[model samples]
Target: MNISSLKLDSSNTVLVTGGAGFIGSNLCESLLSNGNTVICLDNFATGKRENIAGFASNNNFTLIEGDIRDLNTCKKACSNVDYVLHQAALGSVPRSINDPITSNDVNVSGFLNMLVGARDANVKRFVYAASSSTYGDSTNMPKVEEIIGKPLSPYAITKYVNELYADIFSNTYGLETIGLRYFNVFGRKQDPNGAYAAVIPKFVMQLMSHESPTINGDGSFSRDFTYIDNVIQMNIRAIASNNKDAINTVYNVAYGERTDLKQLVELLKKYLSEFDSKIKNVETIYGPQRTGDVPHSLASISKAKKLLGYNPEYNIESGLKEAISWYWKNLK
Candidate 1:
């Protein structure tokens, strides 16, 4: 989907929290390219400064080095901003399991601070990152918006809390909000080096170096792997859509197709092999399933398509091919 053609007002100032992270940095670049003033607020905890360095020189780009856990920082970032894309939160289920307190402090408390700041500032709309983990334990083949199960981890709880808070803020304070329940998003600029790095990027890096990529289970675990461009398109649509019914609700931002871990590795190797054939021979190791890991997750993107007019441009194979090219050039 070509989001640049959307009717978003380029004259407005948009605030993207965690703007130095993978997803946030992409949004910042897209927004800036579309001629919008962008203020990026990040503390550099998990977000790297280099991610935003490319566009920092752009006149329309501004960086506010601050933490969202601090209400004052959140308020300052929101001041004079026309829209808020809140993406600053600690990710990874295992990381949350190890440090639940810190995760809650940032994801839950920090989210509330942003909402309050946006509400007080009278921003036109508050679009934030929600998670597919909110579908925890639900065995539904294709997870929908209305049906959800108990959170499987502290991280899941934090994301679900975001939806609840967004709903309440819209009802009580009259803040127009949209929560995007992102599936397993992966693409360029996604971190490939971290103890809690996502599966796709991490595996890509490992395979590039001819290291054995380990699977948590027997490689049957599946996820609705989404590409970053689709996610960016969804965020833009959320801000651009004037549809009243779409304002205060959440929609699953995904490709609506599940890819198993085995299939995922095969695809990654297939693409990376084009750059270095040795990657094709790299063996994979299997490990016990990690705690809080959902056996399978798939999203029904009908809500996003029907309401927001979402049209995901790339599926797993195509997105992986593009991602492999980036990793080969950048990380090789």
Candidate 2:
């Protein structure tokens, strides 16, 4: 969908938790450019300052350096906000498996804190970063929002709990909430140095450094890797939509297509090779499958298309090309 068609009011104040992270920072940039007052709340545990450095000086942007685990902090951040885009949470399935307690505290408890704060503050709407991991062990192709399997890891459980809490808040207290179930989102500013970094940026960094990237499960696993701009678009639409049916429900935000790991590596090499010819020859290493990882994940974005009017502007190939260009210019 064209961004101009959304007709968002620039005078509104929007609070985006985790605003220094990849997705949150992008949202903040978009909102600020549109002349909105943007408040960013982050603890900097996983978020980096460099991601937000460029726009930090913008008059319309304000940053709150605090953890969402604190209820008071959440309340303070939500005060006088027109909309709340709650993107702060602990991500990564393996990280949750290794330390479930920390994950639950940050993902579940922190989410609850945000909900309560938003409800009490009387924000117009509360939108959050729900995960595709909530699909869990469901082997169904093109995963729909209604059909979900049992959660496989602590992270999945936490995200599912967020949905439940959102529903309860909506029903019990008359709060408006919308959940965006993001499927493998990636693009510029995505961290490539972390142990839990997503595949795209990690592979790009390894190939640029002439190191073989280790693929889990023989490179056959696939995912619906949505682009960052598309994710930003979904968030904007969620906040802008006034339809009652669209609120208080979840929608799958994706490009409605899947690319396997083997294909992903091939595409990355093809795009990155334009910057460095030797990158095409970079070999890949295969490792045992990761614990709590699903083999394939594809999303049915029909719900988002129908309800939110989401028309994704970038597919995997096009998004990867833009991402590669950014990495080459900034990191090379």
Candidate 3:
């Protein structure tokens, strides 16, 4: 759980919007551990209170129960903040497809509110969670930042719009920003029992409960699965980097390797079998691939390495071992 970052050690105060969600809470936890004052702004709409329950006793941690959709709330959260990590958005491509209106209102409108608030507060840096979904249907293997295809879903559209907004804010308002295009991020504190739960956690929970997990699309679909701690590294690097060229641009935050659903399932079963041998015999059911899903996905981390000095330490196996251990002790 130890973390290190320059220029973000103790003198800075960071505003982590959506700080109760999986990624945001991890950011808050790392920042507080490093002696930085952490302000967690979340509405608990999608972010659960239990995710941040341990921090309630920490003196350096402050929780602001609010929504990003409200301009006043964004401004209030941004007040006197040295940095802004804008992570408040309705994630999931399927969710956005089901309710694009709500997604747009929260992702686009709320993002603009935070940008305006950050600009007014004169925050030093704004690092926000972008998505690999921005690549859309480019048919490109190893998606680069500059090259992106048209969006495949409503959620992809919203995230693409976020990059657009961030670029404009940097140009028009002079607000420094960095966008991290996360690819299948999974690890500890991630929700395992939601309607739109991510694949890894959801599979773990299901397999532990002796239920067969349904893999959409013959288990051939692949993703550049990234661990949460790597994501944390990228966020901190994005905040602390001094390179002017790194600012106002988006970087792929990933492990730079592709993992198919079948390989992922085998690894999960192998890991979970250590906890319960019955899990090894659990069967996987194949289902129709859902809408708005790409056949394959991966990322290019060269930009992040050269620009932000980002070095992801955990690959899928190492990360899953750590994550499964936590879930075994905590959830099981």
Give per-candidate clash totals: 0, 0, 0
Can you give the lDDT of residue 188 in candidate 1? Answer: 92
Give every collision pair in model 3.
Answer: none
> Model 2 over residues 207-296: C-alpha lDDT tens digits?
999999999988989999999999999999999997788999999999999999999999999999998999999999999999999888
lDDT of 2: 0.94
lDDT of each: 0.94, 0.94, 0.93
Q: Give TM per candidate.
A: 0.99, 0.99, 0.98
**Comparison by TM-score, 1 against 3, better one:** 1
Query: What RMSD, rounded to one decimal, does every model reach?
Result: 0.7, 0.9, 0.9
Scored by Cα lDDT, where does model 3 land? 0.93
Q: Scored by Cα lDDT, where does model 1 land?
A: 0.94
User: Mind sharing the TM-score for model 1?
Assistant: 0.99
Which one wins by lDDT: 2 or 3?
A: 2
Off by over 4 Å in 3: 5-7
